[model samples]
Target chain A: MAKNEIKYLTAIKADKRVKKFCRFKKYKIRYIDYKDVEFLKKFLNEQGKLLPRRLSGNSLKFQRKVSDAVKKARQMSLLPYVTDLLK
Target chain B: MQLLQDLKLLIIILLKMELSAITGFLLAITNNQKSFKNDPLSLGLNSYLCRPKSVFADSFRTMRNVHWDKPPSQMLWRINRILNLPAIAFAKAGLKQKGKMNNYELMVIFTPVLSDDEFKAEQKKYAKLITDAGGSIVAENPWGLKSLAYPIQKKTTGLYWVLQYTAASDFNEKLKIQLLRDEAALRHLCTKLDKYAVEYNARKKSGAKTGTEKLAEV
Candidate 1:
């Protein structure tokens, strides 16, 4: 892929809603672009299907909301819900 | 009669200038001259005593008529337990309280991958860990899957578990150590419950038990 061609998955993660919530919550987005989705997905697989609060740096209330959103995106083929792709 | 005199003397010394009203109220309630239990007037005063600025609010609110000629330790524990209820109530009502405290409430969240069996097993392990460390298990509720503020371990939705327990000070550190080591634990929080809150709970349970008994009789 050309450098100028942005990764679609990365763009979704950096979407305004995602960034705004993450920024407000002081969480660092690890995926730079769609190119890194596979890497991030692998890391998540390692943590099991659910993520820990410290790594995500989200309050309990917001953490639940974000987890649901991730699952929804996975079901819609927006994101990979399982670990097979990363492996 | 002599015991009452000794109690009066003790209250006079312990309470100083407030002895008169305290003594009068005790006599009124204990003699059944007036039923302080569920008395609206006393309830109003009790509420007033709950305010932050009342100088002796805690003492005034918690003081009970004891046979003072008896050991102080017995009276102290009884009153302390009585006082614990309102303290918890105050905290639940969002009032900050002062004292050296012991906290026992805990919340634990887990990832979604674990099956019901796995979750129950972990819950049992954690409960045992808590009680072994001198905590009491209050309740454990499964909150089902919920969304996160951000993705974790790559996925978003995760299984949720809430556990309420009463434990000692060191229990927090012990639990955290095990949680960090376990891959299943996503998040956990522990908050201290005031002793007064515990007392309030006991009184509530007693009231509920009586109400149930009354219903059964009818």
Candidate 2:
């Protein structure tokens, strides 16, 4: 606990930007469709893995739907189960 | 006394808004509503709500190898039997959803070598196959020559046709067999649509655009 370190901590600032919200809830979407490939892709990373709820800005309820849709899309070949980084 | 209290809590939840729909679905199936019985859950929940004790006893009888030497373990086993009622019903329902028409959607990729007339005829033939088998086609969308996300059968592009239909649970097997026999089909997938999916597809066809669909236009 140095006095000089306390002075340096004053540079920290609170973020004022708007927080992320669940897109499905904002739009009142009751269903997540696997056939809607482009929409499902938004919830996947470059490696084609499902993005976590924290990263995707989705709530727990909507996150479940998203994961279910992603898996179904993979099964139907609407989306890749995995992708190469180069691709 | 604890069991009664738990049932009371369950009843209160059933009466509330959160589970009313689920309770209503259960009640409808219990009443033997034909249309509602299409969902596999309806059967399980039906038996569960109407005669849980009978199912519990039957299922427990099948699992009867548990040693009855200890009284405390026997008491715990009784509790476990009560907890397994819904699970047993669901297991049985999952296996036998026959003679019930439920929502289904089929997607097929036809080889790109087909002529325009051939494509039309092929789509019509499949549609007829569904109707002739006592099922109804809700919508038939021909996406027409879309590039595959990955190479399928060494082809980079395919004719994508999607069909939404309601049929008995076993009917998809017959459709899959037919698709396999048809040399023109490159790939095929048939999926069972839950209630939400049925509503979503209906809404999509009714000109209510989903978010991605609107973005696709731009």
Candidate 3:
């Protein structure tokens, strides 16, 4: 019974997906500036909320920077705070 | 006879000294208390001399009852003046160095209801403002009638005009105030560009021009 369980656990481990690479690091982006709206849009959802680091595959530091940049952009009306479905 | 003459001179000197001493005493009595207050040393002595014995005891009681948490107004003013030195120096430096132009990017959104001629005229008016302030326009891009993500003043569309210019740092404040006062402008943002951003913008504009030329050829 223990051998069967071990075989099942190993199969689950093998089936797990590979970790994704950070896009900013891959592109060698030194700074995540607020003015780069096109580049920043990749990290935002349809509702204008920032995607989690886990889902976006961004490094923890870069994710923080991106969130800060997004806030600044929103303050200047460069990006929307929230998207309305009816609009 | 010479002894008699010496006695006479001594009497004259004594009379002169007595007369001077009486005049000095009269002058001291007539002097205003305000004159003593102007001199720090005299003011300290005057406070001690002028106050009655009971007042001195009352002052000691007041000193014991003083709230140490809130300092005297004079001390607070002194500290505030010291803290403001850096800001004062910055203002002085800004005044001394005039006409040192810096690169700036201004993005203005006009209300979408204007005709083409009016829009062109409004653009010329802003360009004139820049020139009047000793600034030169580098590039102007009119991104006509774009839809806003959120409605501004109940308007869904706005006419966007982006301007790149070089002007003195001080001119930005004046330009911003003018934009705010203008009824035609829906919204405006002016950003000071560092050397890196300025160079990047120049390169990007050149690349865009060449790309357009190539497209036209094709």
Candidate 4:
């Protein structure tokens, strides 16, 4: 039974897909800027909320930068906090 | 062997307790719920949560049907002030220096009611103001009659003008006072540009499409 459990665990681990690449790194973006609203929108959901790193597949540092940029964009009125019903 | 097993179990239990404690602490900090509750000024959270379901439903229904015919009554000036607090603080700290020439980008939204002649005159007046202050206008783009995201001073649309210039550090104070005194100017934002920003704007103006041009194309 233990042998079967170990085999199953190894199989699960082997089948799990790892996200080792970051979008910002791939694009060679040095800083996540608020002015780039189009680029920033990719990191947001339909509700205008910042997606979690797990879902967005962003590195920890890049995610922090993106969130900060999004907040600044919101403050500047470059982006909306919520999508109004009237669109 | 039993004693060793017991020791291992105890260590595991302690580790589990510590992990849980750390997770709770992290959750508290990340959610910011405790801070929101503690803050006296935050009407958003408590009001949103404690409001009656009927009231919530009514607002949601109204929100869906609402049109832009009537401007939103709440000006939210306090919210605007709060949002601009960091910029204001930075300006206060940086404004002590007097004769340093710096690049600045200014966007002024004029009341849309102005006639074409008055608009031209107003533009000339500001252009003269920059020259009189010993500053040179690098680029000027007049983005005429664009709909605002939200109405300002009950005006649905505004005549947007963007000016990039190099001026003395002290010139911004005078410019701000003038803008504030002008009733025709609905809204204005002045941002000091760094070396990189100046280069980017120059490049953009020379060949690349300006933001308004891109919008126009769309």
Candidate 5:
């Protein structure tokens, strides 16, 4: 929790990558927390474009499962098809 | 008195004619039978002469008239006939490779009576069988212990598990036979999913953002 502690964000250069990729993809990162519903809503707003499997460094099998879970969440209205502009 | 009687009789006749007209109209719409725009008198006479036949008879006739001996018109009627023909032939084929049929979906309901470890063992066993049977498991999740919607063998609470898989027809037939023999599976139902349902579901899952980016909160 210390200011100078080595963070996961530092390890992945997460913020730098987010900024760099968002600009390239023309996506607006509503939030950086991937598990956050707000971040998912922002992702859905861009339509079907999902996180690159390599960037997540996840196994392809696990990535596929995750992708499918996300879709099921969206259809159930747990994730919105569009971002709430005010949020 | 005779005048009054005649008026009553006229009213009854009119009511009967109106009923016949309404019946004919409904019959035409439902059966896609060409409408008989004839007066009630004619319609009623036809009904009287030949016990009212459903206009569905027309479609039934078209189904039967497809002669293998002659060239089909290759038009809408032929198309309609072709579509209608499959259900009978498919039904006769008897669920062989039914799981492989396009749009087929299997809903496997698992109710395990064993402890968690035993259940996991059973899950692994069935999961392998499902894959080996040429069905791809699509969605699986625990519904937890719950009561059945209705009493099956006088049991109330059951451990609920659901599996959605797509399989080929013969695979399904084989799976169904296996399930019948398997003791762990309490009840199972297989229903074909519609094309639109599958497409909509796939689109909904294409991109989802959910995973812990940081260490556990606690």
Candidate 6:
């Protein structure tokens, strides 16, 4: 019974992750271009902060790609360093 | 994860609605539901709104423990996002905007020492070049002299000019060569405008409030 319960718990964990699939993999996107500021905003919060990899469900490789792109976009002024939307 | 994001968005919308608050609707609640307990219309908001306890101390909990009597259903939220509905979902979320032209947005930083006449003449030269190349200029905005975030060629500031035009797919290479040959421009970038960027540019041109959300590019 103990073994069965552990198996059941793992099932639930898998079920939880099923919904959080990595979008880059789904879209088959080979490159995450920083020029697409509009797309990069998905990885940022309203306050212009980068969302965590876990929350966004980004794979490790793609998450690094996103961070690099976001930083580049920020430098290019295509995206903002800080957004004062609240003010 | 999307549910959490949506709940946070709902709370934010509710927070904003408080400004012209008339009637109270069923609002989703975060754990620290103290502020809105009473007549939230009067805005008894304090710590809980900006700085909730636990996990965080200086901001709203965002998506944590947001419970409401009549919460937006998960399926409905997903559908709403897919449809790219306004207010929350960040203007259509993941879905691509429909009917976008193949347009490119170009930004060039010219040496700041150029006189106004020189700048206009140079701008006209590019405009004519674009027209001659079977492309049409959609919009032009001269940002004037602006300081850069860092020094380029030891200069602290440069004249910024922006242009949006639709061109052939392979035309970018030709344009790049032209820009590379032009010594007057300190820096330049040409990006194909996606549907969202197109929508954003149109909205901004309409003089809407959303334009202020992005900061002035330094």
Q: Highest lDDT, which number?
A: 2
Clashing pairs in 2: none
TM-score to native of every candidate shown: 0.34, 0.58, 0.54, 0.50, 0.33, 0.44
Question: What TM-score, to 2 decimal places, does chain A of model 4 have?
Answer: 0.70
For B1-218, candidate 1 gives per-residue lDDT tens digits of 54555465456546656434454445434533335543544434544443445444444333433323334334333333554445554553333433333645555667888888998898899989977866678766676677654576686777766566766565688788998888997766554555543453444446642121221221
* Best-fitting candidate, scored by TM-score: 2
Tens digits of lDDT, candidate 2, B1-218: 33443354355445553433356333542433344324445433434433323323332222222222334234333333545443344344332222458899888999888989999999999999999988999999999998776777788788989999998777888898999999999888888888878878888899786554542332
Give per-residue CA lDDT, model 2, range A1-87, as digits (tens): 776654554676667867888777776777888888877777788898988987878889989988988887776567776786612
Error of 5 at A39 (Å): 28
Q: 1 or 6: which has the higher TM-score?
A: 6
Q: Report each candidate's C-alpha RMSD, comma-separated, in the order given.
A: 17.9, 16.9, 17.7, 26.8, 18.0, 25.4
lDDT of 6 by residue, B115-144 (tens): 999999889988887778777898898989
Question: What's the best-to-worst order under TM-score?
Answer: 2, 3, 4, 6, 1, 5
lDDT of 4 by residue, B1-218 (tens): 33443344345445656433333333223323434323434422222211233222232223212421222222122222434333342233222212458998887889999999998898899889999989999999887887765567887788978889999888989999999999999878787887756766766678874332322221
User: Which residue segments of model 6 deviate by more than 4 Å?
Assistant: A1-51, A54-87, B1-101, B209-218
Better of 3 and 4 by TM-score: 3
Can you write out model 4's per-residue Cα lDDT over A6-79, one digit (the tens) per residue? Answer: 43434344466765567666654445545567767777887788889888777898899889878866654556
TM-scores for chain A over all candidates: 0.41, 0.77, 0.74, 0.70, 0.40, 0.74
lDDT of 1 at B65: 36
Please say which candidate is ahead in lDDT: 2 or 4.
2
Off by over 4 Å in 2: A1-6, A16-21, A84-87, B1-99, B211-218
User: lDDT tens string, model 5, A1-87?
Assistant: 677866464455435543222221222211232223453443332443456754544455544644654564443333444444423
Looking at model 4 chain B, which ten-residue stretch has the lowest summed lDDT? Answer: B68-77
Off by over 4 Å in 5: A1-87, B1-104, B203-218
Docking class of 5: incorrect
User: Candidate 3, residues B159-199: lDDT per residue as tens digits?
Assistant: 98888999988898998889999999988878777775576
- State how far residue A23 of model 4 sits from its true place (Å): 6.0
